[model samples]
Target: MKVSSCLFNSLLLSAGVGLLAPLAQAGEASEEVKPAPLELDTAFVTATGGATDLKDAPASVSVITREEIERQPVYDLNTLLRRVPGVTGGFGPVGEQSKIKLRGLDDKYTLILVDGKRVGSSADLSYRRDLARQDLNWISPNMIERIEIVRGPMSSLYGSDAMGGVINIITRKVSRTWTGSASTHITVPKDSDRGQTTQYSANASGPLTESLGLRLGANVTRRAADEVEARRDAQGDFMYDDGAGGSKNQSVNALLDWQINEEQSLSFEAVHGVERSWASKKTFGDWGDTIGVSFGPSRLTRDSYILSHTGDWSFGTTKLDAYLNKYRNDLDMGKANSEEKIVEGSLNLPFELLVDQRLTLGGQWKREELTNTNTLGTVPVDYQGTPVSGSTLKGDYSAAFIEDELFLLDNLSLTLGNRFDHSDKYGNHNSPRAYVVYHPHPDWTVRGGVSKGFRAPSLKEGSAGAATESGGRGCGSLRPLGYLTGSCWMAGNPNLMPETSTNKEIGLSFDHDGWEAGLTYFHTDFTDKIEYGPLGQYQGRWWTMLENVDKARTRGWEGTARVPLGDSVTWRTNATYMLESRNLSTGEDLISSPKLSAFSALDWQINDRLSTELSAQHVGKQRGLGNDFVQSYTTYDLTANLALTKWLTLNGGVQNLMDKDLRDGSTNFYVPGRAFFAGATTYF
Candidate 1:
């Protein structure tokens, strides 16, 4: 069938199926509805790589609920991340390539996990780093149940990449006996330079029996071609511009959970997705396809599996709990790819030593193996029109850790944790953390903490190959340096050292009545920071190299507030400000980090059937690695949701309402402009 025809059919089928399933089940006796009690505490998992009440956990944590995700009308992961206190978006020019920053650290310093397992490649490079973080574009907003963000060193619990923080993406799970919904959205650009996007998604979850549950979801997204006018320089040459580009994506996910016995449970999940797009860079009187020039037509696919078991037993007054998990990941990136496997287990014991005091102990172990392959160029073809000169890379890592939490008094608590890891690439290392929490009153809480963390080198850091003149054909004259250079070049390093960091933080949280607020201050020091040097004059051509640099520091403050104006109205605002400086022989501000960032939203519930929200976001100016300053930018968004009936809802929003013309200094690219979107969700 024709692609367009298939899409239409799929939409209709999904909508019909989703609406009908719930209605059919509605005929049965309704189950008891128990509204969860409202609480001011945050929810998180990264601090321990397991679900832990944020109020009791030893680290600084934050949670963005599903309601918050819809309040700001955010569609991509970057949009959601901007709301995070100390985190900042990265230097990539395109949406798919954007990175995340934590405590002023790059993507490699922060770890991202889905369902508590790492799945992608997170090689920290200077030009374009590969992060294991899932691409938000492939995930529909409706698929997320909630997001848990823990800030600060957590390597003791989650291992490498948890040097600065962790982001755990929890997808929608089956919660009710039977549920299903479908939604459709369209984004309309405000100007000719911007393009339009249309998306459709369907999700369903229910119990096959009292002991088994299942969930299935799918989404398809499309973007119409659009062009951005070039910005010209004094000599009539285009300084920067993104030409016409378009993209299409499709994805599907399935999950199953089973209760094998009273003491054990098992769950399985799978996801598949594909994306295609054409991008370009444009200059006055010069236009070229970005593919192969900037990068090429890229394709990526991933497969993952997880198995876990949990059990509990009591030994007198001491209680023991243990869990074991096995995971696997397979990634394909056209000319380059990787496969990884890991097995991990943990044990925990919590006991009361005295009436008002308690002790907690924990230990964990993990084993991992990775295999990778990469070709030299866009076309791996050789002298005889056949692919040649590829490399195979492999490695392993292992770690163990222990932690303790002690309640010194009814209002005070202390926590201590340590971890040791040994890797074939980096030998051995250890990390330690300590924290104290004091509650002077029922409405106020104070916390202080310090920690050390480290990140090991990735496969690309050591085995990446270079286009040397002696080893390859047509590589002799390829030079990537200076203005008249031959293009771009990349080379690897084998002697690179692991990056290490030390962090200190203090914070206060208070809530009473219908108002809540929090503030935190943090400082971080980094050593042996990986530096990807810019293209330089090498053999008369521009060449790039990866190297480890000296010390760097970042200090920042974050503040948040939420107040209820009335029974049906609320106001929420959050702001993050940071001072980042790096002294790599040359003193300068870090690249890609905004000195000030903020997000605020006001929501109103017009009765139970209608609601509206307004939000604003700001990003401060930043300096590039080259010391060039980029202008700051701000944007406003508006959204409205209406419950037309018990089973039908409509949502509409407009983003970048100011039509701001924003450019990033690091990547020298302009972001998307003002756009409007509307969607309808129906449930039987």
Candidate 2:
């Protein structure tokens, strides 16, 4: 099957591998057992810039706690998040290239954070390729405390890149006492030709002195390439390219905290990470004949330094942060580097108006610099009769925001917020949001919100000197253009406009003695969608340019439920149903997005030392590259954990119990047939 550019192809071809993690042992038996409470009361920090009950957060939120993480057999962040409502993963040939989508929006619209700080996007620096490895797996699961996921537009508080939502990973805190853990996980597919994966991790946190503390963590992971010998399909196309590629990754982080006084603290942190990926594919001619075979390898390294301070006064809490981050991408042909520096601060003040009110004020300043190999040369000058030359580009932005949380009634609360941002490149933009939360009954909660969000053009997308080759692949149009055949040029448009969206949602949830259920309906109107397409030709050469020429509408319903069957058994499920996800300008449906997706799991506690879980994931029919539909499929997994001793635990599982590979369909994504995994953890 023919596809568009490499980026488009990579976006369509993702893996649905089921990686498992071990769970905690069952609790002791008790007579007249009462069902446990759901996540309604969990402390959530991402939704409102401060800690609040999950049920009270203004936005649709989900939390994955440490206990939940320990009980599952998940090794990667994508696998851990695929079960959440309105969340999906699309990975490239390299399984580690996890591209997450929230509410039918791609990675570019979803803001990723570590401890509520942006992790700067490396994917924005490249064109026609997927370099978004920085999004997921940057931190080891062993060092994580919990994850907070807020879905829908959040620009009113977070500014840009939050049109779809935000995902904040909260790491474990430094303990007063010495504590640490070491773990190893391995996955081996039933088909030897497929890839095999393994990972090792360790973490330690403790007090260094009466007024100081330290925390450290490290992890390493490696995977072998599938179909290393390179296989071809009946049409003489390289099937090996469809197989999961190989990857190697490493990460280390350290943090030190000093208590300045009873009401103040200072902290410093450093993190370093590396990612390597390699694969091979065959070149094809216009006549569908093999031309040559080539191997591609790339590396990415990131380093970050952060200094922060927090102070608690009589009426408010103050926080300040200064951070610097650096990234380098080394491709087989060229190299690119980027640096980001940011200074941000926020204050939360509580007071009594007629009722009660909590006011939050924040401001931020950020600068980004990018230098790449491809932009080092001058433009051809044939297109516009003028040559453009640039090797480095820099951009800066400043933003300020204010929010007020008011309790007007005994059971009702309202939140109003707005943010203003000014950038040298994009001028001035404003985002506004309003939300309400009400407790109709003691066991029920009703919430709704409306928000506006936007995304400014990246440096690589707005620079006339920036250019990328399509590698002879056609544009979005199916029928090939003569001038677009064989190494077409895709240039940047400095006049491009920003993408914007208006989002609305309402949700109702009920939680009573572990019998929990929730349903949320959301709608989004996305305008000025940026796309790379034909501009104008000169000297018989076609030049594609990024332009704001499209609009899209996405509406969906997300539902979640939890039930306690007995004292030792529980069942949980979540599902998403898309009502519409269409590009209004092109009249084409969003590709690779399932209309209905659901995940369910059943957990049983057999004894004090053992626990078992049976899980299933269902992906409904989805639009394909052409006017076709990829059939729906479901995968099952069974995992069990055993506590060998007080400090040692062992677990094993079988993924894809049915081995229902979609090879019969036209789906380009890879689905590993069947896999088995085993793991062990040691705690002190």
Candidate 3:
């Protein structure tokens, strides 16, 4: 099905953002000193192989600096995402199923990383391919110094899951003096069983000794399960019992930086994160003439651990960086349990020389293994949640890569890169990318790039395991209000080929004064997409199988504008418009991804001691899961900061200030209502 007219929404969004453009034109008030220059030329690492200015980066990128993070009242990744353009955050049918979508793509396509290291995938391994409801809850906001989001394919620099984009979180730096801060915040909802959510965090960074530096941090969050408010089925024919959303998570990270010599240095880091959440679904059952409703729990437990060492050495014009990391994760979902372990090591040497050019050579090796248990946990919460029975899956790969940057002219630069990887599961594959940047004027930069990206088949997708789920709404055998048992099966496809895509994009940006604006258009053509079979009947029962199928095309346009109206007032806005997203094979539209999304933030610095911000997010309508349409909506939020003293500060905010009713048509995700929060922070 074709979605709403993109032209109309694009115009509407552009008009809304256009208002902020004139704010930059507001005449400079007498005696109002010129604001500092915008950070358009700020250095970032994730978009490029190394540090580069934002305007020099090959792909589209956005950054949330520490100052911005501190100003917002966000406590979790999901909430933090809403502050960015094209990303959406809200409730799901089951509170635990809520997620963040990037450019109309779900979390599965968007990879998550901390300090340039990949995190474990939250997609269920055994069966159903269901994603973790809280994909970003494990990250500690207090530990982050900045977050860099790169849009479009980046599989050449990173690997896998970069099909949509990459979110790289950079942690804080250590200081010479003993320093730390503590803060706590709570949110009170207007209504719904979800109740209240609270969070606490503490962090310290300083010198442990003359030659040693250390940073320690910890965070804990608790979200009371929201009680289901509606009982009627979509058809309003029968009553069903559903589940609640109760989540609790805690994490800690430590880092030790040591100085061996002026030319060489080494660091050791460790991170431990854990999360526990529960989700439930109520389905109607009919025994002969009588109709009944039954509910079951889908409990999940996830823990992640990382230990690594990083070393850097410089000899004259040559530099070398080496890293060794061990990553491990464990998951327990109802009757299914899985554990994954990965060991990866790499070396990056940029000592090679070419024809008036610099060449960077890199080599990496990685080993990964997954173990799936057939039985449920000691106490099974859902009988049907068992998947993969019992099996061990393993994959190994090694690769070598090189990137060369050549200056064709004083104002033009060209970059070319390629990597060859051999995988035990999918044999050998190669990825290549080319990018160029031209500066016609000091304040203007033009860039365009194209590349091939791929996502290797996971061990679970190649094993003999399968996940089994047996309940769904609106089964053909039953009416809209009645429940019919329909089972979902996604057995492994050992012969599956790695999913690959051809990604291309180009853009231009203007950065001058205290204002910056940019527009980028991207298109990705994907082949051999790994997807599940349509819901159908097998052996007199309903089921679906995992298979590599379909060709998809996703193309979109993104625009961002930022202007510091004055020292006291600033305006920022970002708008995203997806021209098209569809599955070519079946000719079906990608329904769950919104076609238009936008975010606008207005900041007021009343004084050094007082500041306030108003943020608004708009999400266009789209087809919800098994639905024709979900309505579009807008949300307005207000937040403020008050400095009580030199080292003490207070914060308060109202989320959903308008209290506009919200319900996602795709998954019956209903908003809990307006919320109020207050918090305090102190530093030593």
Estimate candidate 1's RMSD in Å.
7.3
Query: Whole-model Cα lDDT per candidate?
Result: 0.62, 0.76, 0.63
Model 1 Cα lDDT, one tens digit per residue, 390-491: 554556777777766677888887877888888777888888888898889978889989999888877666544532222221222333432442344455
Model 1 lDDT at residue 421: 82
How much is 450 displaced in model 1, in angstroms?
0.4
Which whole-number lDDT from 0 to 100 does residue 642 have in model 3? 62
> Which lDDT value does model 2 have at 165?
95
Itemize residue pairs with steric clashes in candidate 1.
292-295, 382-386, 480-542, 481-541, 481-542
Highest lDDT scorer: 2
**Top TM-score prediction, candidate number:** 2
lDDT of 2 by residue, 1-684 (tens): 222344332222211111222223234452322212222325888888567888889999999887667664455687777779998664333422246789888778999888888888677445444434545677878888888899999998899999999999988878777888888877777765676778899998888999899999999988766553334545656553455557787899999999899999999999999877765323333434332221223678889999999999998999999999888878556668889899999999999989898899999999999888764333565245567666788999999999999988878999999999999888999999999999999899999989999998888878877777666553444234445245656777788888999999999999999899999999999999988767656555567777899899999999999999999899999999999988889888776678998999998876656677899988788775457676788899887766556677676777788887765425545567777677777877
Q: Which scores greater on lDDT, model 2 or model 3?
A: 2
Q: Please report the TM-score between candidate 2 and the true structure.
A: 0.90
| lDDT for residue 455 in candidate 2, whole number 0-100 | 91
Local error of candidate 3 at 25, Å? 29
